[model samples]
Target: MPDAVMPREAAAALKGDAALPQKCLDCGQRIGWVELFFSLFLGLFKLTIGIISNSHALIASSLYSAQDFFSSIIVIISMKYQKRPPTEDYPYGFGKIEYVAAGALCLAVFLGAITLLIAATRVIFAGVTHPAHWVAFWAALVAFGANVMLYRYSECAGHRLGSPAILTTSEHVKGDAVSSILVAVAVLGTKAGIHHLDPLIAILEVAHIIFMLYHMLKQSVGGLMDAALPEEEQEQIRTLVTAVDGVEQITDLKTRAYGQSNEICVEIELDPSLALAATAPIRNAVKDTLLKGLVKPSTVKIYLAPAGEGRALASSRQQAVREALARYYLGHVKRHHLEITPSSVALRLTFYSQVLPGMRKQICAAVGTNIENNIEDGTVSVSEV
Candidate 1:
């Protein structure tokens, strides 16, 4: 897919306390209502015709449609709640409710599939009376066409809005479409005197339902667990942040999926002497770059840290000690003793100095302060030889 670049104006529009755009929310809700209506209608129509025509496949397909009806209800409820503004008690908003709804939908589907499986198995052992009526074939065909339209519409809307609930509902509609077609074929086979074809097709429909349930379950569980974004997307974010002008180093980057969007936390190093005012532009640039380059909706937070000495100097306590000596202009034909520990670094310098005793003590104090600042948790002592 082409990279999704949200416009600067649109990103800015969401900066304040506003929720998502009303237009998008309206569209999602409209789609959910439409799905709910069609599923209910199809479920009733198929169930009624399946019984009249004595077709096990049509009955099983009707159960799938019934599951879709309930799933649509959950999707609608989740879409409503997920749009609510964040509160102090739940700072992240209710976006994860979509995943919760998806999990519930999976459970409904699992139960329906199991029920269909048992009924079909019993029918297979019981003997068929006669071929299914031709009216059931026509009903399945009509359900198939309706679901095809719903699937396309829902899939398009889901991608546009980045709504997980809508996307998962679309998958359900797509499966319904496929199973309806299979039901239609089985009905025709029964008319051709293949009595077992009906129950066999019902069993196949159950298998398909279970397969789809597995995928939806996995996606919902990942969302609930706050899984990280895909590796490629994380790399893309890193590349964008590194290209900003003032970022000296990236110390850490964290990304996690929050509902349909991603949340990113990045820590970057800047010049130690750079003014705080100078970092604003760099921060804005990184945020804009990520919003434009990433495929999904995203929120970014950046932390600024002062750049320290290079890795070689940071690792070697001796280098830190030498820097302290140079900074203090300490004159010495000096021998120094160094001690390093996990908690602190200590350096004792014995040197020749012409300075008075009072000045020498002051120099020692200054050197100790310098070492603490540079080595970050350290002490130093200086004495005349």
Candidate 2:
């Protein structure tokens, strides 16, 4: 009963972007390795400087770098999850977990910001602050440069992959770039006689981080909750589906996003006179049309029903019943006989080759359900001949 999620925004983004040739499932692997080493370098460099100078600002920057370090690890883990093929146990594939990863990254950013805010506040009110050493200045500069490079790399790759985890964490990494810039300013400002500038910049960066995290959560939570495709895209899909030959009208359409693509269920109404064989190809055409430029992998289901105003031609009893059977199976015919009696009906289905015993019960149950729906009162029997 759960709804489906579609990554619509990324699909839209992909429209104007023609340069990124590598948005495959394995996109984050290289990004992870890149961020991993850089974050480790940045975190260690800043932590060392912070320890030597006893500066909370540098120490907190070190923690921010450490957060990036962990995010890279999470990215690698989530990438593995993203690459998992759909199995019998997981028919929908493992793409939705990327949104979960994005959520986790968002939470980490929020917690880091809050922690930074609390620490900065204490330092602001705790009277005179210890002066940061010259080594702290070089550390801030190095962190700033490294963060800028990481931000650019993450942003481009995330957009290409349509991955919220990559995008959100990249933005978080961008915040670190901003943080280091402010840290550099704070150090220089304190040296230039504005002693309060250090903590003030920290406060500003905290506010910015909170604002960014709020937006990331707002966007990501919807996807995690099986958000639908946007109205415009829905209309676009509607137009495409109905344009296919033999689709008289579209009665209903539903979409759910899983990873980068959409899972769609379309209800198509056709003239009742249309043969089941005719409907099958129409369904396939509609699927191909909708998926041509779609960004994500999709599973599409087509439901066919008679058009509301269409009427069937009158036929003899035997012909009508056989026609119904043919329509249900889309004219994939074998030797079949329908036996009717008051309060009971039986169908003998003769297959051309071996009938798998496992499928025999399923076929019978399906035909039984169909009979119950149509005739209203017969217990149907299914026998494979």
Candidate 3:
């Protein structure tokens, strides 16, 4: 939604450390803890200096730090649960929990901004003024420098891991450094008996926080709704899948994020005449390529379409009805048939011709393992002709 998001080319430029896993739970956990510790330290340090100096700007910045501390803790907690394998109750796994945590963090930042704005307004309206406290000034300087270092480190980890949650947290740190400088300048202005500058600085910082909150909320909701991958990412996936040795073309590709991880599903075009023996290795090639290059252990479903017959083969009754039953009991059979009652037209599916006898059982096992994949209620009866 926001034009501020990185473009595809820019995001793609962020290559990983050759040694890093496409996705790593340990990396996610480490980044969460790093941000948590950094926020906690800054919050306590700033609060101490703010109270000693009696500077409203310092106090406001410190409260923001406190909010960050809370948000980071939530992230740390989510990272632990988000790695749980998909269960019967939660079929998609708990990766989306990271997005939920991100949403909460945004909410906290927004509320903190409101509170800061209210306090700044009180100082403005009540003609309350305090001299710039030297102690607060020094504290802000140290906080700013520390934030810079943390932001760089977090950014490196975020890109290497391709974790949106980590990337967002790193961006927060960068923004906080800028806010610290603004607060420091306001403190100096207040000490010069220019108290008006305090409210102005607060207003600017609050405005930024409001926009960031909107962005975070939008992204969080999009992930929950299973939004399509950004157009550029889709193109990259397409290029990668099609370039694989045996893939003819890409029919469709779908991607959605779960917390800090990515999931991709692809439907591929293939030559019908290729020996059934060749299909498995080709499918595996596409899968291995994606797993190694793009997503970390993502679920990839490949739909094999015989060239030219793609459309005619898909919606025909024989393929449709038989596919449903095959998916249920035969483990994803290739040969199936269905007849339209009204027209008494017959449709034939020759998927069996696409696989070798030895491998049919394995392929079937994969297809039939998930009964929920059945698109129709279990009612089809088998008949011998």
Candidate 4:
């Protein structure tokens, strides 16, 4: 028989840390300010140049900058909701808001792509009458420099904080960098009398937007459905749990991400011979081990089951015991545990029996002799599974 296990919530909260959320908030703010500053600066700069120099490629890139600038505001706003503690009305917290913000950014990218492509197609057919002025080249160069800086900072903070929004925004900024380079090339091409290449650069910008939008859409949908963590991370979690002493085997394990962090649930099998008091420390140790390896969970559930007969390897030995005993009319045996010591063995169990109080002694004698084979010193308590 296995001892009663500790409550999973108490065990998971043994560390009592929710560092991931706050970390994400700080990362978002740092990256958000960068997003806003550069977008506003470059959007106006390129838009003004595109109109003055008659550069369609620069015009397309300006629309993208405007989209990025507004999406950064969304990212900053979403962080406010994500920073709140779990409330009674919302047990899992507001991690999904970041995902919503991500989706919105992707939508913004898609819309900008459409707008850019439409303007590019019109420019492609219209034919360039004159090359862009030298000022357009300098504008693209400056925009590329700004995007490169934003991408580095955002990529660093995104990976460190494990924020999908920051990472997505970084990709957006990278697209801007590439767009700026293409605009620079298009201006040079047009100056050299190849007017068609200008719209080609704008078409390339749309391709980048489509690629990023696909990724953002997939992740946002998966996050809402409580998708599992990556395969590598899941394997790491499994290895940590298996390393704990006295843990016979993992019966079940599950992990899912909410806002910025993840939640884990684990059920393990333990030796039947261990007493209830002995199992408590092992439970705490396992929880602590998990805490070290994984994020603080929004809801973690852990259960312990005995290893042997009723649960472990019942296929060959206990299969016959369960079927024959039920026919012999003892009861439906929920679980049976046997502990062996030098020269003696003990049996402890729980089951449901309909036998009257008057027939209890007869049933006990029959249970000991027929099923357990030596239930002399121990007792069988009636219960439900």
Q: Considering every candidate listed, which one attains the maximal lDDT? A: 1
lDDT of 1 by residue, 304-325 (tens): 5556753233356556667777
How many steric clashes between backbone atoms does each model show?
Answer: 0, 6, 9, 2
The residue-level lDDT of candidate 3 at 64 comes to 59
Rank by lDDT, highest first: 1, 4, 2, 3
Predicted candidate 4 versus true structure: per-residue lDDT over 1-385, tens digit per residue: 3333222222232235556445544666677787888788889999899889878788878866876786677667766677776675786678788677777777876887787788778777887666677788999999999889888988877765556677777877888888899899999998888888877877777776677678878988899888998898878877987899999989887878765567777777777666555766777777777665563343445666667753543232234334435644445444555433222233444454554544555544454555344233333332222
Per-residue lDDT over 1-385 for candidate 2, one digit per residue giving the tens place of the 0 to 100 score: 1112333233433556544444443456688888888888888888788779655567667766766776787677777776666775777778777567657777876787788788778877885367666677788888888888889889988877766667766977887877787778778877887776776776786676667667766766777788888898789889888788888888788887755556788877766656445655776787777666555546667766556533222112234356446644543335675533333455677654455666655665666666566664435566676
Any residue pairs clashing in model 3, and if so which? 132-191, 276-354, 318-338, 331-364, 331-368, 334-351, 334-352, 335-351, 335-352
lDDT score for candidate 4 against the true structure: 0.68
- Greater-lDDT candidate between 3 and 4: 4
Q: Give TM per candidate.
A: 0.74, 0.71, 0.75, 0.71
* RMSD after Cα superposition, model 2: 8.2
Better of 1 and 4 by lDDT: 1
Per-residue error for 131 in candidate 4, Å, reads 3.2
The residue-by-residue lDDT of candidate 3 on 104-196, one tens digit each, is 777776787788788778877888556657887788899899989988887877676666777777877887898899888988888787878
Off by over 4 Å in 4: 1-28, 295-300, 310-385
